[model samples]
Target chain A: MNDPKSSLTQVRDRIDSIDRQIQELISERANWAREVARVKGEGLSAIDYYRPEREAHVLRMVVDRNHGPLSDTEMVRLFREIMSSCLAQEDPLKVGYLGPEGTFSEQAVRKHFGHAAYGLPLGSIEEVFQEVAAGHADFGVVPVENSGQGMIQITLDLFLTSEARICGEVELRVHQCLLSQRESLEGIKRVYGHAQSLQQCKTWLRVNLPSAECIAVSSNAEGARLARHTDDAAAIAGAAAGKVYGLKTVADAIEDRADNTTRFLVIGRSLFPPSGNDRTSLLITVNDKPGALYDVLSPFAKRNVSMNRIESRPAHTGKWQYAFFIDVSGHIDDESLQAALKDMGPVAEQVRVLGSYPVALP
Target chain B: MNDPKSSLTQVRDRIDSIDRQIQELISERANWAREVARVKGEGLSAIDYYRPEREAHVLRMVVDRNHGPLSDTEMVRLFREIMSSCLAQEDPLKVGYLGPEGTFSEQAVRKHFGHAAYGLPLGSIEEVFQEVAAGHADFGVVPVENSGQGMIQITLDLFLTSEARICGEVELRVHQCLLSQRESLEGIKRVYGHAQSLQQCKTWLRVNLPSAECIAVSSNAEGARLARHTDDAAAIAGAAAGKVYGLKTVADAIEDRADNTTRFLVIGRSLFPPSGNDRTSLLITVNDKPGALYDVLSPFAKRNVSMNRIESRPAHTGKWQYAFFIDVSGHIDDESLQAALKDMGPVAEQVRVLGSYPVALP
Candidate 1:
């Protein structure tokens, strides 16, 4: 609401008034969610406070209708946090992720669930899965892939044994930085970093601090922690991690690759209906023979279904048998997908549906 | 070679004789590789020393023909090194990988190229690609995926632009250990590790050193270095890295997930023919329309080609066009695969064949 005739003071007052209305609207929306939670909690043994399908639907709408000075992604990220704050009012969502502290997995959790969700750092990916499966946490955030690296195999292997399913997906661009509390990059005797970050910023360290002894630590945050106390040491981490340890950045965005990104999945115990645009993951093993894999995939091919991902792992059996993990387009609730899956059953030794989830907007 | 009763002096002589024979055989193999190189290099202006298809075939043969107390994988690993040594006689394979020395990428490079191939640690994945593409290196070894994590998007995205192709693949089982110069874990004040390792050993650290501050460093090797010098610091890293910095393992195999692994790709300047059992990776951008993915995939489905992996990325454009990176079951040289690609051309906006290489043995 802008007025050309308004003085500077009047404009400032109008801005403040608009801000108050926005806060009121947000509060009202949160109140509605709280009431909905109350109504849904009754007559049900358990009310799934975090409905991924519903959240996906809302985010899609927000992104689709946005026409702004702020980019669509930026708008969606803002709304996501607002929705996260609102969702917390009903019940603060508990999220488990892989970490000691300040890990990408933790960042993924914060990014997707927003500031309102309680973030719990687990020891490992399996622990994150167990935390959700055992009911200690409402949801789990685990990295499934990094754009620079390939898939995280342990996450996929865990799905073979865990009942937790994919409820949503999120991706964050990974930008590594060289951080320090030191006065300069020069005169640094040692550089601390995580293994990945060390690798990511390998050249910069070599060229900039040729004689500094490079060391790898647990996380970028941990690297920054050591950098804070060690006089001549600098840590390679992210800008966020640098702040967590109160370390100043000697150099930021030092990763060798600029477009590096990581994709994470949100896991929960239950599955829900489709959000129209969705992706489904499955774990299957085919009969160990010539053309065995072909048979297993034929059904989806015949049905005009698009298979998104198929990864193979050795079955760990002494023999050469293998297990296949697959991701395909469409939700299981869709009729055509159901028919395609039925055909997969006979050809595969075992076919377990991991989960059907909304495709990530970004 | 095994002299059951040879522990005594007389038997020791017999063992020595067997060792001589083994050395002679290896030398002979190297001589053969040298001779092969000489003949191949003649009359050919452009020569490829590292034949990924040929190496894959040999490794396959080594496993297939094995009859031993050592498992197939173990036997194959031994042969891989031996082959690497033999190939080096022609010209030591120069491989560049992401590293600050003693990184898992270095390990992967060593594992694939063997002791003879020169391993160069480049600072970035982009550098690794550039090294190979610019003819500065024979091949570049970089991680494409990890078991606990998913695909390395940087690698895939790089593939979108680089002319280098994937020729081989290798996987290393990631085992994080707690290393320190200290006598025991009790007095530990700070545990240093790579971000991945710290999380991998989170549970173990929490149980043993509840109050210890966990720090992240550049690489596990870097962590080992920090732990070696810092009296109260312990590093969670691989045994190889611990040995590099002479840090003793306070605790071994501390990763929460037992089956943690990282997958790496061998990239070179040109493509190679199939090695019987092969996997092909491709970069495909689909038309911006509903069912565009389905249409591109339908060709493979119709031909009964077993598709291995397909992932989606937003095609950096104004209207959110998407790119599909895929792995399928055969080399591009295969008739059926060629037919599938021919069919794919019409449905997709752009298609680029990444490479075809043997599936990892382990």
Candidate 2:
């Protein structure tokens, strides 16, 4: 019986059978999710199906229980996509991110919600926040900070005005590639990249394409797109973004910094229940006096709540006063955080709890 | 006194006079800086002339003493440029940043060192460190984090390997603009931008120039370069960067978020003395256990060191373990911080101080 077919064909047939089984199981899962949605929404005019804490718990389980050839992160990604499809069957989680099809913001959305969720790539972080706030999208993804670049002031400033709450956070490592339609670097008249990527790959492009004009594009994907149309142009973008246009990689990982990572926030209407490993963000305005910052932070010190991050932003338009964005370990529901928040009132002019959400696991 | 003089010309004349006075004062200051360098270098063949603490004090004084039409930040910028010139006169403070002249990293270098110093735009953050380590440059500037984007991982990762210390930090607000040599957006068939800028201006571009093929470039200045040559092309970049190439602003402040601030670090061979308002950074690898991070951070909490930021990065390849980058308030010289550092060693597998530098005053 084994002699009738080659190993390659037999393996291919096995893979097809496995895919069919996987699809069947996913369909069953979707059916259950839909049934649960119907049961939960019976008497309600509006339904809230997405649960952050539950999803976090499930993802943690996926990582914890994973015993495979695939890495835990890789496993988590696959499971999340499956969950995304299941959630979509109940009610598709409409998400917004900065988009023109192939930017990193879109990647963040896909990473967090999976491919089954709808991705609406808006023009700006503000638009993203607005769509979520206006209830057009269930949640919006926005870049909060870059490990290399620090806090995105615009996103922080938007937090001051927008009521959208931080629902979750995710990080993506940025690996830039130089992609073009041309087979070789010869006859290349120009190299296009994102400003950050261009800045990241400044040395490489300069040394390699000395005579070619280097241009800054909006996104690496956009660079790939431009490279696709222009005969003499090459683009610097991520492998995933570059792959979309079928552009060939002329140079891979052209970024100057080897570990360029970006942190993104998922913003929605309300904060979810806490995940065990969590972070609480607070925006506080300090008093106009010396040692103002010290006074604001002493409460957390007293409570021994491990602070994750503290960044100062210029308060209103052209003013000298500052507001501090503080990230501290522990959910807001935790006892230490409750005590700390109580004492924080007097020291700060204003204190707003951004949210308490699960910390990103790798 | 004012014959051919309009109000604008008279003001410009007054500015010229003030500028001449400034030049004289700056020349005198440069002489003093050189004298200090000579005095400090007297006995030693190898000399460390940069004083982060002293510069911080001076900047603080500039902010404190200003009673002005110009804001404190604006005043510090002017003084920093002047002081940069003075420092250059002493050692020519050769500084490196990821640049092709017009990116924000170059702005950061100019902001910290002033225009008088030689600006070397290297290819990457690693190259910046290499130049500084090799003594080709006195110091290198790298972006640590952005308000929106979070921490730049490459810079953080470099700290794990580099001996470079954080000497100082500065923040610059990102204000992206649409620039062109073209008369109007009407005939604009192509819009060029950097990735970050493109992402920042996504909504605006989509709404304003929907049909235009948005291209990604290496730097906004590079985009300005392309727009200068191409008839139908417009570039999105910083105003100052665009101005260098004489590109006209078709639309200013096109960024989605208003407070897109980027934080940059001045990295060098040594750490700075206490500047009163200081922040100390550390690289730590935690032991494998539950709440391992908590164990490492408890010491800082106990000492009331006021933790600033904490971020986790995967420790080596194919490993589930992580290494953390931490920032805390107070200099290493401070009593509490010194105590905290002493206690941190036992709890962590490895602990390395990145630097103790003055907290940036926005």
Candidate 3:
């Protein structure tokens, strides 16, 4: 049998060797990043705007091996964030989201920015984008769609009208709670929540509280805070928001749909650094000719690129026409993506890049 | 082009033909099921035991060709119920579940049963199985695991001790709502809900209703009912339940986790009809020998089968030992399953089949 002391020493030595290797690798990477930052500061930009293609190529190489618990996709996500942070160190970004306190958008902001940038909260959605365009904030968070409620038209309209680049995306699960100020279930008559919250719990409200008048507020957290002040009122909000507002939850898990989820968008003035599994959003207006829309999109389909979202909005330029907002897989730098966009040019009257960013996964 | 009226007529005729074909297919399936039931009934007295192998083969055929918006795995679930209902027509099956009203278990029962059977709500989990054994209920529903709180030990303990067959399973999303009688935010003092509901919203309650006393009741619906009886007290429950009990929603969506989901089990005396993706639960007691547990599970891993849940309970023989409840994928009738169970005979002091049922997807 091996001696106990020897076995313990041997294990510790192996761990120390692994730690030394990891530390060396990390230090080397940091040095390279700093060098790149200095080069960019000297007006010698090292970034490859077309780097997503190169990133995808690198990941495919690792995935084809299938050697470990870390899947190719996972490694790519980690590396993408690492590289993004490193590059952004040359020019740090600031983001604005809808909040004074807890909100889903705040979470989205954190998710997109990571620890690389500062997140600021504004009073309204318009203020969020304004902060970005006015250079107060580098990015903005806005709700795009909810699983049960279809698209958020306000965000789509903003994209159409605002010049801020759509830089990134995030998805958050929506859980609502009934919060109250009262210690007892006595004489409570008022309910408050965002309009969307009231709609999601419509079926339940119709049968249970037929006589109570429902009121819509700006946010669930605010509603909860209001409920804290009013003995007869309760707020409908996410459990986290309720906690922040210090509202007592009377009921929970109240969304009409069991799998209720919400998707949010991040907007900035600049494009995101390449992430392998990236998606680009664009607003395009095709020619009036029949099949023109098909012609503009056919190049993507033929190349097997997938489109995630497609929506049409009125041109709003007194043209009596509509423009399509399309979100498609593959960043603008990919060869196929470039070709597809090039092919689309002839058919499109206007084509605007909303920006490309990393994909969010469950 | 042909006349518009004639084209419309032809399209309508084609739609009618498709509808007729659908009806024919449904009838043919029903007839085959009835024939299977008849054959089984005739053989019941001649054969004391059911042929699980044959049942499994039939289910495998159904699963193989499943093209689905709901995956092939999810398709097996509905087919399992249809087959179970057919099998039950030959001999009545008793089911039990925790009840009074407005519990998620009730929804699980309806979902698994498909509105064909009567669901009896028992006073307790023990009563649910007792009713099944006494021929009062054919199956029982009990919450097993919650996303936020982990396992419901009482339910686990019952599975560890009881001999009831777990014939099927289902998952349901739970939502909570705050209910009240008042129309305006005025004098409310107390809040009511199930203990777990109150716990989930503890953070929310502290901030919103710091002065309000949170009281735990038997069920969310019960809380609502109680709240309805009092003027200032509010109840926490499902939105539907709140409406049914005539309570106003003061707050909603109060769970800590936004993606909160619950998994429930359906227990009956009879074995369930096979579904391709089945999970068989077993409670095992070993002599506390080294490698004893490993030996029992190794066979499954060797056969490429995955185990989903592993729980331990006191052996209840007034000893310091424990029994393990394991849930593994694969129908018990499968060859790999048979081999694993057969090999387990010598290693286990006692190996009892808690049940083999279709895994429910939320």
Candidate 4:
């Protein structure tokens, strides 16, 4: 056996060498994460695309190959952070959501980006898309529908008029909150929230806050924030806003419906190859006649493509007619989908593709 | 034809008769809505006892009997309003949610209650649930999970430790936004939002407002309202708050991930017989062993019951001991489910039922 001093020296030298290699490897992995972020970023800029699955797949592979104390899930989670940081380094994507701060839009951004994206609060749905279109940000997140309230008409109109393609989708679980500066609901003057939120809380507001005026805000988050700043003013928003603004919750769970939710769409510059479970959105104007509407929809009916949404809006061009916005299952690239579009050409005046994206679940 | 005056008189009498019937009918319907709301109110106070399907079915029947300009869907919608109003009147169920205002929690309340709920905002998750248990409110709403951000540990903890029961659920589409008091982010010095939101917007915050301090608030709504009140402060919230507070959006869609969403849970009194598609939650403690977990879960496997969630929390009373909170797809009253619980007795030190309720969806 070697002497104790000699053995210690040998071990120290080996340890030093290993530490250097580990540091180098970490730096290399970080660089790779940065590179991946750069590529993804370029695509996002020219076209709105964020491939979460692909990135996740890569992280999984890296974690599996690692022979360390960290578990694969933990390792992947850590790597996700590294990758997110890299993406941020590449290009910061600005998102516009209906706002004050604690609104569902902010929650949407958090759900979409995890903890690595910047959430921008916007005043309206149009402004959200406009920010993305004008290059002020990489993507726009807007609410398209609600389970109880139905669709957000303004968002549908944006889809009808904008050239932006639908890049992604997300489902958010919404919870309405009652906020007041006072500890109790006594002597409350006004209840503030979005029109939809106010409508949802109508029954409760009427019963409990019978004398209180129900004021509409642009977003639930905004209402919460505003309530924090005003005296005797109550706002309906998420609990997050109350904590953020240091406001007390006078009550909770005030919605008339129990299973409420909102579906949001991600819009960007370009579209991607359809994932099998794709939903396509389009806008069409048919001749203002009885069966003209039926004719435009016949193609979809014939092809057996399921129509998920069908809404009509006035053609804003001063024409004595309305335009229909349709959303159907299956990608535009599908044979039947193409055939359906072809068949609808003669039944209308104008047709535009709103884009195809994956279905979302919450 | 008869004399014009005499004919007019006859017609006027007929019209008056019709009008009297209409008024009586409206009053009757309104009263019925209140009664329905009362029945539903009992369900809210005891949410697990609330069968959404039953409520929906009843409301559907009411709509089917309606006669007038309103279509079947419209009639049902009106009935929904009545039911919601009635429910609010019953107990005026108060709820606590993470807030300032206008956050997804408010939206979730709207989704759950239809268009009639009394939403309350609180400073934190604990605060929200605390309101429910303390009788300050009838129920509470809080975010439990996110598509991008994963589980909300705080809510999980509340469920694990609190006396409140899981009554309902709401999934909302999250839409994030960027708002500033000014028109642009050019001179923004600070970005405000909840901690989770700040983390979600990390990439964008680092890039655009690189030098800006990202302050964590309770909710995004409050953050936006704060921004509205202060100069050089931008808030990440939703549009609702902006409309209420009159804040401008500077940038939008700044999340690192494009598909973001948050899932919220409704908490209230003990559950009763579930509606269709039920879920049961329970907490169990097991002896230390290699296959103890497997043994505890074996009952579920044997019964062919699908388990949705299984999480472990450190036992509050001991060190190195943990309690498992499990959610499964079966009612406790089911033979198989009861048998599973009986079988679990040997392996578990203690077992507590959280609740058994219908699977509410968006």
Candidate 5:
């Protein structure tokens, strides 16, 4: 018989060699990123060196070229992190998001900007915009909408006044977990989570921890923090929060919805150039007329620009007057969108192009 | 000036007399509601007596006829509550909602069904549907979408299998507050809230309670429960939650967004007739083709049936295939929508009319 031990050893050696090669390629990529930084000059700020459009383009290519046992999303995520790590070698990008650490916003920052980027957790979405506009942070990631909810009005309202521009978007599938120090559900005396989290997991909690005193806390991280300290207490939070607070997951994916996604926008000081596939957001005020909305919409529809979302808010300029926040496919630079804008100028009271950036990866 | 005290007393007496007259009218309305129950027969279930479409029509009329100091929205709300109270005199509508009590879902139930309706706080959205379907409850209130988020996938998915139909909608303006026993931010060493609530009030907390340890809990009411017990702890929750737990609001309306609204759907056993101004939700599956989405959308666009929202989800039947959830203006019974559906029949694999109900009161 053939030597089975020798064959197994040979396979193990091949695996080790592949890992080493992969590590070497990553190192080379980091060197290339540094070289690019050097070519850009040392005087330039980290924000200038970080090109969201360029990164988006590269990520798109990675997805397009991918065909493997690994899913496209997983492959893209890996590349993004690798790119983030390499970018950090030159100068870490400072990204701001609403947080006290371990919030979903923090997770979104990590997801988009990568682990190597410096995440500055701000107190509010307004502060996130302020920080980005003031150049305190390279970019700010604020939630724009939730799949289960409609829109984040505060973020939309900020865009009406703030000079911040949308550079990218991150869609995070929010998963809630039951974190506890106890090994089983029976030992839990109280359950802690954010109010929303509690509602999200109401069914699971009721089925499992029916009689437990469910408490509301500031954040999932906070719940995890409390759970860490108390043996009988359990928390409902994201797995990331549990990891941060060193708690064990008694149960996972406890959210009521299977696809609980929150869409976040990366806000920057200036609009980035298009990355082939992109989305344009506009803030428009229409003239008070019956067909004003139809007029605004017809331009896009005629031009074959697919409208992604439309939201109406109090114009704040006049009582009962409304401003429409519109998201449409195609970058502002696209000829079709340009033609649509040209057509819209006469019908709309005012049209403000918020930003044009790459769409979130599917 | 000569007899100011006498005038004040006379005004007080006049106010009391008006209050008595109002009470008599309210009593008379309640009696009529009982008569409605009696005419409908005692054998009918509570759900049978509760007509969401009828209530919607009445509320719309209330808004249209109002020409007073009170806003149209305020007027509609008062009439709704009064109607709800009257409906309860016949037989309290058993409304199920995703809850442990003091949650937003429960709030939605009360907002739509009113205080007199027996609010059955269920564990999950599925339970809500199940209860309503099994005839255990008159109607079930469950969150379908948030103005900030997209759609609740689980709810949509349930529509595919559940027999429950959308009866009405309730739009609740979500407001968060700081509740405490110590009465001030200085004494608060720990803050409790849901993860989302914590993030919502992140800026406020950072500015006000920078040093306070924010903890995550299951529900805001739970946090209030905790806050009620601890002198040094505070909770970020709805004002209702505070009332439920006997905690005083240290600060109110501290949410990051001013117009944060949650849209909940009232689901029942069968579809009700249209309320004139109505919305129809549809679940559609399109065949595998390049222009499948375009084909699905063209019918609505061509028919001038305004499409409100469209959401795509995994079909679950095939890998990478999708199913769409669409919300459109007008009822399924309306000619425009009916024609649109007829046109869509040839293009779509399947079309399911989930429900047609009144547009939510503004």
Candidate 6:
């Protein structure tokens, strides 16, 4: 028993030594990132100093090299935060997102850019695009889709008119919580939440707080704000909203669906170079005729290029006319995609390559 | 000029005469609807009394028969409301939706089922499904997609597990407004809105109320509720929300995107027979192999089924595995789709027919 205890102490000592080395290496990496930023700043603008594609490449490499008990996702996340902190040493990236703060959009910005980036919570998706286009923000993150809901039309419409390009994507798993000042659900008379949040948590609330009046608020954070002041009111919101409003979780993971995910796009002034594994978004208007859609898709199909998503929207120029937004694997620079684009020209009335950027890290 | 004025009066008299005939015909139609319900009640349950497929067929016919200054869309809407009222005279449908009222979901319910259907505002999408499946509500209306955002995962996820069928669909053009008790934007220290509404109206708010604090609440109606009580606060919401809360519109049509729209699904106990113009939604899981996605898509393409949308979601049964939700133009009962499904059997690991229903009227 004494020998075992002594060996455990030795193991602890070794771990302590390793942690110190790791900490020092992280500091060293930050210094190197600062140096790289300085060098880039000397030759380029502040916006150009941070290369999202390069960062994506580095993170991909981290995943490739990782073979551990910890997941590749965890490893990539750790490296991203380190890189973000390091990059902040020179100048923090200014990121705009749709927010009054404590919304899922804010969460997506943090997941993509990390905590080191300064988040500018704008009022709308258009503002996010405008800020990025005007260079008021280094980049903007706005939600393009939810796994449950089909699409956000405003974002797609903005892309049609704005010069902003897709630079990266972040998929956030939306989790709702029951928050309140009260310790239990028993005393809760009213529940406040964003309409969506309330919808997300409805089943749970029905099963638990059967009689509570579910009040729809502007945001989950706003619900939390209201819940904080009331003794009998609870709020349905994200855990972050709970934290923001200083509310405690009366119940956790109250959302009806376990895998409710929102997909957000990082919009920048220009498309970045491919990060080995990338996706290209295109806006296509097909000639109004039978098999027009089939003709538009055949080029990619014949080339064996995989399509990720395709959505049709009213072209707005004419009644019954539509514009299709397509997401396909590979960058525009790739040979197969280039060939596909060339072939698409004859069938499509207009084909605009929105941008090529790295796929969101899983 | 005297003759023209006299002729105008004569035209007005003719218009009044026509209006009287139209009103009597509408009443006659309502009586016939009630009579049809009585006949249906003899052999059918209350749930079967409302046939969405039949209603869709009638609406399509209305569009086909129209040759007037009123657009097909306008004509269809008017007929829909009439049908809704007629249906209500027999038995009002208890339609469940994500609501505390004044949410877009509520609007969709009204647009599809009309004011005649008793809107059973539920807490969540799951509850909506549960209500429909359990026969507590005659049908449930839930948002399946947005044009701006991609999919609502929870709704799709519910479809995977619930036995509810898609009987109809509603597409609503979302419009936001600034409502306040105050006369104008001046003296508004705070603006309250649902996060999405705030985001939708962000550009207008920023340009109009630069110094006002934008506060996110649960729903736009909730925001209106707050705004109604305060002189210095304004709410960004839909016109319905403003009406519900007794607030005047400070600014109208303030959404950044003119074409902001949401797609909602009408869920019921079982699939209704096909309308002439219909859409089929399928859930397919493919084998884990290269070109698997292509194999799944090829079947649809070869038959020229014309897929409307395709979305991939985590299968949840395993990590990195995906299940696809596909919308194709045509009913499953159609020969082409039937043949396509047969061919898909070999390519897909599992295939579930979610539902086949009428395409939403333009």
What's the TM for model 6?
Answer: 0.45
The better candidate by DockQ, 1 or 4, is: 4
Q: For each candidate, what's the DockQ?
A: 0.01, 0.01, 0.01, 0.03, 0.01, 0.01
| Model 2 misplacement above 4 A | A1-21, A42-47, A178-190, A203-213, A218-235, A239-254, A317-320, B1-362
Per-residue lDDT over A101-139 for candidate 4, one digit per residue giving the tens place of the 0 to 100 score: 556687676556543455667667887787677765567
lDDT of 1 by residue, B1-362 (tens): 13322323343243233333333344445444554555455532113456677667766765665543334554555556556655544445667788554456876886677655666656699988987887756788888777556788998778767798888889888787888888788788998877877877778788889999988986565576567678888988766555434578888787776777888999987789788999988888875888898899999999889987778887664365788888999888999999999998878888888888888876
CAPRI-style class, candidate 1: incorrect
lDDT per residue (tens digit) for residues B1-362 in model 3: 15544554453344333323322332334344444434344543211223333434444554554333233333444444433433433332334567643346766775565323444555688877666665545457888888777778888787666678887667777777667897633567898988988887777677767788889876664576578779988876777655434467777777766656788887767675566667898888876668878987887787776888887777875465668888988777778877887888888788888888766643
TM-score of each: 0.45, 0.45, 0.39, 0.41, 0.45, 0.45
TM-score, prediction 4: 0.41
Tens-digit lDDT track for model 3 on A1-362?
15644553453344333323332333344344554334334542222221333434333443454332333333333334434444444444556777642356765664444433445656678878776787656567898989778888878888778898876677777777777776544556888889989999887667656676789986564566577677888778876555434467777777787778888987777776566778899899765678877887898898777899898888775474578889999788888878888877777888998888767543
Cα lDDT for residue B124, candidate 1: 91
**Per-chain TM-score of candidate 4, chain B:** 0.65
What's the lDDT for all of these models?
Answer: 0.71, 0.73, 0.64, 0.66, 0.75, 0.75
Could you tell me how far off, in angstroms, the CA of residue B221 lies in candidate 1 after the best superposition? 5.2
Worst 10-residue lDDT window, candidate 5 chain A: A15-24
Total residue pair clashes for candidate 6? 30
- Give candidate 4 misplaced runs (Cα > 4 Å): A1-49, A52-83, A175-196, A203-254, B1-362
- Lowest summed lDDT across 10 adjacent residues in model 2 chain A is found at A15-24
Q: What is the lDDT of residue B96 in candidate 4?
A: 65
- Residue-level lDDT of model 1, residues A99-141, one tens digit each, is 6434557667866886556666666788788878877577889
